[model samples]
Target: MNVRARPFIPAALAVLIGCTAFTSVQADEVQVAVAANFTAPIQAIASDFEKDTGHKLIAAYGATGQFYTQIKNGAPFEVFLAADDTTPERLEKEGDTVPGSRFTYAIGTLALWSAKEGYIDGTDKALLANQYTHLSIANPKAAPYGLAATQVLAKLDLTDKVKNKIVEGQNITQAYQFVSTGNAELGFVALSQIYKNGKVSDGSAWIVPEAMHDPIRQDAVILKKGENNPAAKALADYLKGPKATAIIKSYGYHL
Candidate 1:
């Protein structure tokens, strides 16, 4: 008697098929509101996160204050990476964020940056010289980094001296752009914006001393809308992990 031949999947092929199916079933997309200052770091982190977790991040970069307003207005954001800890704490208190999901992801540093090489000299000399006609900063009302800039000016007693030359951008990205494009002689921007691999990536910058302004404790939280989104939770956890922390540090943020 002839036996019917059996169709069999090899063990390795079977495991591969199972993993593919598992990833497909578990993969999910999260909508994230990222602070403008964190744009590059988040982009890098998001890429690694997708590859490692098989989850996707759709990020929208803007001022943390604007993100707060949007979230309050019922925007579809599932996670928030804010420029300050206060905003995320407020969101958590207001029930806009998942309980116990908020944490400081990075400590931001302010920088006085100019597109011209060797222009900043890493001190207050250029700012005090009063030669530059235009100085840029983000809108203090809508960005924490902008507020810090104002604070730095106040501490340096240059608020009135530079008031006439101050050019305000809607957000940190625009502030950096103002200087990067030579529309403004210099700008107050996030160190992470111009930093890479532990140094300024381009242009000249003076890393503002932490004592000049309040500690920029950047925080991350899962929003109420993401309460049940595994991808959001996964991302929150990933930010606290080694890979994301390394990326954040490489961009000059303190974890």
Candidate 2:
């Protein structure tokens, strides 16, 4: 008949089904972009967060600068934990992060470390002495620890001496790896890398004095993408709480 049957399940019904599918896909999970310097402690924290809140955290660790660029281009991270206050402050100013949700979670320590015993002799001058053929440091533009390393070298007037021998890593984690893997005889790395049970690692290390540079105030911020995400906020708050602070401090981060 010209009346033709049941109107063929309505175009509106099909549109509604498609919209449901889209929403389900969008609601999948929360992601966090973390700075490489804080890798170990954050991994532990993320595990505790997932267990306590029943929320999955997909963490991506890289240089803070790279993560900043990604977030600006809509990489879809709900939270950002940076190696320094500078990038988080910039993101907040750009409105990429939730305003007033930024806070310092921990202060990082810089150390010149060597897998070879007594390679550093507990002095910054070792960098200039050419006691080691290769030295690793994070890229100053991408990682805060790299900036600190530069400052320490400059203060010792060893920047020129060691500049040629320097091998730059994209981030602090890789810098640590360079020394550990023997690609570099020594490198500047976060103190947490070698800390276990409130003790330092077997390798020799010279903990850079705090006066050598501006404090490494590692900050965490809630991304604008996560302004309404309960899980993201919960994780942010937990990081500043006593439990997480204790864990961070145990790993040699200054509270």
Candidate 3:
């Protein structure tokens, strides 16, 4: 993944230039098509980015596959933050993005989560027991996390037995909601959604081992429509900055 960076700005000169730009230059809002698994951390990054660069970010969150289809049809999005590197690379190859502007923003983790406390345990005996009525997951064809979940199930040889009990969501966010709201007893979701402030937010969870599935390398790219948009490029650069990386890390994603 290659990221195009702007010229460095000295602290004093940057303040002077930024102060003038903040009041004089018209604000440009970068329209971002983001993957649902990155919703929380991206929101935090957007807040800081707006304050730091005096630029606004209008983000649309959903499955990467859906965003890819929309981008192909000219969705008017300036930036794409995909859950996997594959979509962005495909976009670039198809001439949907600015050349050489793709880069990995974060590596995500998948976890098994339940809304009910003590409903799940260290051992995944319940999975084989088939005690849960429904197991929620994002659509495998549309979501990277869902693909990972399927991989884990296959490795455990539980796919055939649990196929009838699966409920697929449009994206990871919706899948998480299914478990969090008890619509499904347990679900496979991104760790960033359930883990926050150094721990899981609710119920019990199993941090799925990386070996269980392929590494989820999330990437962001500036669309060809945003070739001349400063805000779009700025946001992409900010995503690689220390502050933004820290925020993403706090959400349980690996930088």
Best by TM-score: 1
Best by lDDT: 1
Relative to the unseen true structure, what is the C-alpha lDDT of residue 251 in candidate 1, on a scale of 0 to 100? 92
- Per-model TM against the reference: 0.92, 0.86, 0.90
Per-residue lDDT of 1-255 in model 2, one digit per residue for the tens?
Answer: 387566576889989989988766444356889888788898888777777766678889999888988998999899898999999999999888888899999999999998888777787657666867888999999899999999988988888888889999999989999999999999999989988797677688888899998899999999999988877888888898877888899899997
Runs of candidate 1 with Cα error greater than 4 angstroms are 1-21
**Which residue pairs come into collision in candidate 3?**
none
* Best first by lDDT, ranked: 1, 3, 2
- Lowest lDDT block of 10, candidate 3: 120-129
- Cα shift from native, residue 53, model 3 (Å): 0.4
lDDT of 3 by residue, 1-255 (tens): 999999988999999998887776656889999999999998999999999998899999999999998988879999999999999999899888899999999999999989878777845666667888899999999999999999999999999989998999999999998888889999999999989898988898888899989999999999998899899999999999999999999999998
lDDT per model vs. reference: 0.94, 0.87, 0.92
How far residue 4's Cα lies from its native spot in candidate 1, in Å, is 28
Q: What is the TM-score of candidate 1?
A: 0.92
- Model 2, which residues run further than 4 Å from truth? 1-29
Compose the digit string of candidate 1's lDDT tens values, residues 146-189: 99999999998999999999999999999999999999999999
User: Could you tell which candidate, 2 or 3, scores higher by TM-score?
Assistant: 3
